[model samples]
Target: MALKFVRGQGDGQAESGEGQKADNTHSPDNKSKWLVNYKDRLYRLSYYTGVQLMRFGKRIRRHAVAAVLDAQDWLLEQSAETRERAAYARISLRRTLEQEFFSPVRAFRARVKELRAEYDSAKSQGGDQMESFLAATSQELWAETRKVLGITFNYVAPLGAAALLFVTITTVNSFSFGLKVEYNSKVVGYVRSEADFEVAQAEMKKRIIYEDYIQPEDAVPRFTMAIVNDKDIISTNDLTDRLIESSGNELQEAYGLYIDNQFMGATTDGDSLLENLNARLEEYSTGAKDEKVSFVKDVQVREGLYPLTSIVDLRNIESELDKDESEERIYTVQKGDAPTLIAQKYDMRYSDLKELNPEIETELFVGQEVLISRSVPFLGVQVTKTVTETEDIPYEIEQVTDNSYNEGFTKVSVKGQTGEKEVTSQITYVDGVETERIVLDSRVVKEPVTQKVIVGGNKPLSYIPTSGGTNNGGFIWPVGGNGGYVSCRIWGYSGHTGVDIASQPGTPIYAAAAGQVVTAQYWGGAYGHYVKISHGNGLYTLYAHNSKLYVNPGDYVEQGQLIAAMGRTGRATGNHCHFEIINNGRYLDPLQYVG
Candidate 1:
């Protein structure tokens, strides 16, 4: 065998190996012979192993190829069988659908088509018949309309012609002759109608003032029909002037004072009269710093012709303007109305009222007519002034809710006080009657202190009964069982003397404490069906607006005992209990006693 030299051999072992090598060198022939034999054996073993491995590999490869070919053939066979089965299934499905679904659908579609054809044919025939019927009806209606129109024309034509002829004749006659107006048998002028003559008379009456209904004899006019041309017809104004000229009075152009369009008096000097009127307004406006003064009635001066008899002396004009005129009006007396009160209502003296109403000599009765003079100044002046005065400012309430507090409990933490304010207003007075007042500006003299009120928002879950009785009396809610709440507070404002506990209609009401029933009856006024209980020590409780009362007067009831039912009666707006607590006839706040 071959000697192997290990790598980890010591130097001494290497030296021994060298010696052995030298010895081997000495037996080189024997070593060569052994090595060749070893080589040859090794080569034979290698060649045999390689041949065996090649043979095994070839056999394995051939088997694998055969297996692969078998698998491909099986796969192809399976694929062909699957394709055939799929084609057979597709053909069978098509035949099944054709027999079961498509055939029936086609038959139904054909039936529908036949029905549609029949419906269309019938519809076409109906349309034609309807069109023929409508055409025949339209022709008949047209014929009837023509016949009726022809008959109406035959009857109406003659009457229309007669009406036209009569209207034409009446119009021609109306335009033919005018009225000849003659004043005092002397011809004044010709007017188109008698209305113009009447207008002239009215104008003459207005322009001339008659004493004791005395008028000129010739002032009366006569109207006669006369043939006149268009140029001969005069207007109402022109006829009025002509009649005035022929009145045989000294007619001078003067300024006429018209008060509210009614002629008052005539003045020769218009400027002086207007100056006097302005002086009157300035005199009334003297004391007012910011004042607007004007006549209550529209006063105007116009230039016109007036008879001497109609003109008043200029000196007497001022007296006439200062005179007060009153219209005769009937006054019906009311019950409890005295003669003095009636006189005061009209701003007249009692003596003057008695003189005007002699029948009201003693006392005034209802429905009795009383006469009173309402003075109407001829020249009234209206003076509007801007006035400033101190006024009271109403205080406001500030509400604060506390959830910790029990519901239906209210306490005023700060008392409210009225403040002072200086207010400037524009006040208008017409003939001593206040017509309008408008606030112009306001300044606070003192700041108003807001009233702070704490209201409870928390509602108790249930009522906890108290142990005490009438001596140390305790009150409970009038509306038992969580059915009510304090809708309004006690003594909230003027006239509200109690608290309002809102509940359902017919809800049972309970007595606040043990007490003897004093009054239980329907008030018929504001209290409605009510109950009053008087507890010992001058204590009392009142319940109002009840639907039904369970306890009668003089009955005793315990605390939280049913006494009545809630309702909306008398002046109540809804179902609620108006509860009040009184001590010695003095009204007390219920919230102070009960929650």
Candidate 2:
């Protein structure tokens, strides 16, 4: 079938032909101009289809806008619910765009163009009747248009599906993955990002085995380090080099770096770590080079022994006698006096009295006199003496004559019993017998009278018992008052010991009890002007920081005796007595024992 050119084809141009208008819509060779017609139809269909598609697109856009508005409304509602729900809603929108809109937009646009091309081709091809062809093309175009609409609808369906899916999944995940942070073995802290995770892994590899290098006995070394974030390693050598540069000392030889108990590194150039440590130790040493403590050896002393002399050395004595000897006096003893009593009354040494009265007899009779002089002239005096002797003798003799002839005639013959006695005399020499003796005559008058005697003794004396026993008890308060306010407790800072009590300045401080003053002085250190009194028991009472002390050392003070006046002397901050009671060398709570 020959298709005649009609009015220069639909594109409006001419092709080669005799008395025939040229068809310029396409090339001269008839290559099925359906593309041209299709293009035309596409243009027309696209115009109308675009009109319809634009209407549908507008409808779709409107629907999308409405869905977005709905989604936004839902999001706003979700936001109103709670902070956690609002976050979920935002994540839901991001997921929906990623999965549905971004993935399906390309396919939907391509399908619309395909449907328009098919409709244009059918329109360009002539049909049996114009109406029938128009109807068929219209039907075909409607079908394709419906297909495009279906594809668009299909593409858009997922957006809603994704929105729903994301909302559901995000709701669940919010419960599951809700901002959890945990420290893993690799990480030094909570890892929240990929960079943080990577840093943690790297740090794990650079693990410091601190226990390996650090010996248990090694002194814990100190270091100044520039700590790297998240890493525990220390740059000991670099630090030591810097220190050496700053201090102008050889630190590499003296110091080292340690981390987690491990000796990571040491400095090599300067003084060793040992030297630095030694210097520090010497600073705190009990003995130092400049201040040395040494023992002083005992020295033996030799003494020259000399012989004793009985002769008087009167060289210096002559001068002393000329100066004041004339004023010296000596007195003799009275009758009823002994040397001890005499020496005591005169307040002279007994030995000195004995030396002065060597010639005077210790046994003095009533009229006896002795020399009493200050000079050697008194020693030339002499004493007179007298002696006496006495003797006694006794004798007896007996004789009888016969008177038997007259004895019978008269019983008047008396029994003459004569006891013979003898008397003798002897002459003896005597030297100055000034003492006299009296002799009385001795004679017997009567013979004897005899009487009978009884020998038995009487009864034993009756025993009696007396009744009485004694018991005594007493107590006394050491301090004057019941108790006082606790100013300070048994606490110490630095080397200070004991507590302090606050009392008025110039208050008469009494001895806590009967005690000997161990220490009474103006102590200027921590305890101030302090006094320590030692009671016989282990207890000791300290009265510190006083204004005045009434008694000297070794003075025995009784309980409640005024020993000192309180004052803010020495280290005290105020005018108050600092009283402390120490027992067994340990400070006790004075409040417990004072009252």
Candidate 3:
């Protein structure tokens, strides 16, 4: 390549063209678009008011094309007379003019010639030249324009390409259509815009409350806010409702407590109803001592089936929550359970349970239902019924005078016996409580046997009854140990005049009853140590064969006082006590008085 310079007014030209560079940026196809657009305009205008202007432009373009070609031929003629670089510059300029301007104009003229032939051919065959008073439809006009312009491609391809190009360019700049609200990593709802997401997020925040590190019984529900994340679209209204419902426990599982089979109130725990019921009724049973009955809501509180307490249900619940009365619950009669116990369990009076269940008949069986309520139905009712029970009967005693009997000596001919009598009464109950009892009938169920006694009516004044002293003439054991055996009662092989009691050698003998010591002696011809006491009216108690005598001759002795110790002495062969009970010097069996 060679460079050429042009003289400038600011300084003398010297190698100026060396720094200059030619611009060759355009392609032929890109240049052809301008001619193509201009031709399309002319083709359309030739049928309308610009038809003459379009024809004049074509004639002027022909003359301009001829002038440009002759100028190129003159440049060739001048090139032979110019310097080598100048000659080259002129040739490059001519070629650039041909491609940039002359070629497009020549192609346009040739296209017009071809379209004229085609239009003339179609007119000879009576095709539409569109010269009628009625104008062609837009579809027919576009078809004629394409045909005259000799366009080989779709006319709207540029617009379609521009639209597709715009979409492709904008794809990287896209934002989400809406925001998705997530809970535990699951999509719950959507927000349409940044503003909608903000609003929804705020609404979710309001539903949330803090609950952490709290006790189970005291831990109330605390809802968490829903989080918005980038995701697909959803209905804002419908999902918001479900989210709110999840956050609130207004609808909850609970059991309804029914009284007399009627709805009363609802509680989350059935046991709570029972507890409240028992607490309320505790004072009504007279301290309700030993209440063994239990109460529970009869209705089951299971999911999917149990009553879900809603706001409306809560309305009804709170309506009666403060009321003292509970729904009537039926209690079963367990073993050892009474109507009174049931009443106490339900905080009711015993009469209340009785009145509600008349069939109880004063007896309850296993698995029996006792209606528990404030159901003391009647204002008043009276119940009259007969009751039968046994009573003890007395035995009559008779004493017969016998002059032949010794003083203070008597015997029971026949022993007395107590008997029984059956008595029947009528009981009256008002309001299930006992009010009155009246005897209706009586009869002796067993006969009593009278007792007979032979008394010594001819006894002197000095004689005393064998049964003397206090405690009905009873006496303590004369020895240290309780009675095991009396060796002899009377005149056995040893000719014992009184009873002989076997004992340890040194066992002490006590006085039989309260009396004075008539004698206390360790010396006697046949008897060893001996003590005798004379009770009032000539009654005498004697103890013999003792190792020692404790009472003096005139000392007073009480019942159970030690009088003597036992020993084998004098006529006794072994350690034994000779005890004697006599009234007015007449011996009597000691067993009759002491035992």
Candidate 4:
């Protein structure tokens, strides 16, 4: 590579020559052709530059194609080498496995074949020797066996007899001997062993509650070995019976009262005991002709042997039976449990809770026990009775419509009275709680009265009921014309709020009912001259577009009295009376009242 420096500004002599050339170019003739020359030169430069760029692109494409071909050839060579190396590796691995693992396996297989051949040969020769040896050994063994048999036969009968005698004696002893149970110096019975008597004693103790008998600690029996037959041996229950018999009149025969199959107590006189119990049951029965009473639990008397002290008196048994079934339940206080909360958890009243747990305090600690009161009767008496009672029959309501009053208005016309009826029913009660009721007979003594009520607002008809049929409603027609006719009703036209009564100008309009005048003025907007009358009971009447007003505000006007003169005074095409009925600031159809 060589380096060259081109002078940016030409030397002094060259600069003078370039300046002379520039001046020459700036002349008028040269200046006129300069742009044309510069454009031609620019075109030539662009054509040459494009040609050079094409050549450079052609060179780059050739090099890129050659590089790609070279890379492809290199990859092919590498893949072929990889295949060769993989084949070599595979062959080497096969050789390694054959030498290291399969060689030993094949050697062992050949050795096993040799050993098999040697064993087969040896077995063939040994089979003949074994047969001869077995023949000689069997004969010698038989000879010795016969000698031993002859010796054993000498004592066989004696030894067998001794064994049989020993077994027989051992079995007989097990069967013949038993424990003789003796209690209070008297023999009770014979049991297989003391264990049998112990079981019997345990059972006897269960019946010793309240009995005047020797305690188990004091009644410990003595056991002695004695010869007895198998039939003489007693069972545990039989031993218990013998022991009871040996009590020597300390026990007696009595009737045990069992309620619902559970033994309650024993009584000496069952007949008298039953009579008293029946009386107790009857005491709860209703003294009616068709009344029936019975015990809820099954009661029976079974005859059995019982200790004389175990016999309960009739009065005492009755008192025991009268006690409640359930024991008093106590609940343990838990965390976050208060006295009130504990009461609520058991569904008890606060007062009842306090009564049940008199020692309970307002604050409860965890693990503290609080008593809860709940009762369950041991015996319940179920009573069925047929009874009759007088009952009331409700009256029927009937509604009648009257358009003379406002909608939703109601008034009772007839007062109703409830009638009396006698009803007979079969009622069953258990422990004072009603369980069932069935109606037997019912008869009405008097029929119920039908109540009649007058309701407002219904389909319009020709007649409207009034206190007295003088006019349609409580008010008389305000305008006179035989009966005033309504031309345009309220809501008959758009924006029409009242009824228009067609009449001649200056025709007299009267007050519809007795009322005080609220307004009387020449209000010449929509109503030129009008009179408003306030009738009691939220009712008001407006006479609008009137020619003249006769009543002044605060002045009282009677029914049919002149209040205004009908005329086309304001917003009217012809002479007429615009009448409106208002109730509590609400516009009502005037025709509904007048017509």
The TM-scores, one per candidate, come to 0.34, 0.20, 0.22, 0.31
Please list the Cα RMSD from the true structure of every candidate, rounded to 1 decimal place.
55.4, 50.2, 44.4, 45.3
lDDT of each: 0.69, 0.41, 0.54, 0.67
Q: Which residue runs does candidate 2 get wrong by more than 4 Å? A: 1-484, 492-496
What are the per-residue Cα lDDT tens digits for candidate 4 across 319-382?
8888998866879877767566777887878767766665454224578887785466787777
Q: Per-residue lDDT of 1-595 in model 3, one digit per residue for the tens?
A: 1111111111111111211210111112554445544544553454354557668979999999999999888767875556577878989999987775567557666755775676666667663553431253445545555553544233356777999988985773354333344433345555443233233323222222222111123211112222333444443323433344444333334444434223344455555554554543342333222322222222222111122332134444444644444355687878766555667777876655666776453235678787775333211234455668999896776655578975444556777788899998887654456657789899999998876666554645332334443333465667777653688776674545678899777887888876666577755344657888866566788888788888765465667888888876544555788888877778766655664
Compose the digit string of candidate 2's lDDT tens values, residues 393-507: 2222111223433211112123323333222222121111111223233334433222111211132111111122211101122223333344666664444455565656566
TM-score of 2: 0.20
Candidate 4 C-alpha error for residue 450, in Å: 2.9
- Give me the runs in candidate 4 sitting further than 4 Å from their true place: 1-251, 307-309, 326-376, 433-435, 440-446, 458-595
TM-score attained by model 4:
0.31
Model 1: per-residue lDDT, tens digit, 1-595?
1112111111111223223332332232556546544644564565578679879979999999999999878757786678798789999999987765566556556655665566566567898765665564566556645655665576579999999998996775455455676776688888755445555555555667642223346544555666687778776545656766776666777777767656687878767787888877876674777888888886766565677766777667888888887765879977656566678888887767756665453234578777555567778878899999999886776666688875444667887788999999999976665668899999999988787767556864233323332222367778965768888897676688899999888889999977567688886456778999866546689999898899965455778889999986655656789999887778777766674
C-alpha-based local distance difference test score of model 3: 0.54
Who is ahead in TM-score, 1 or 2? 1
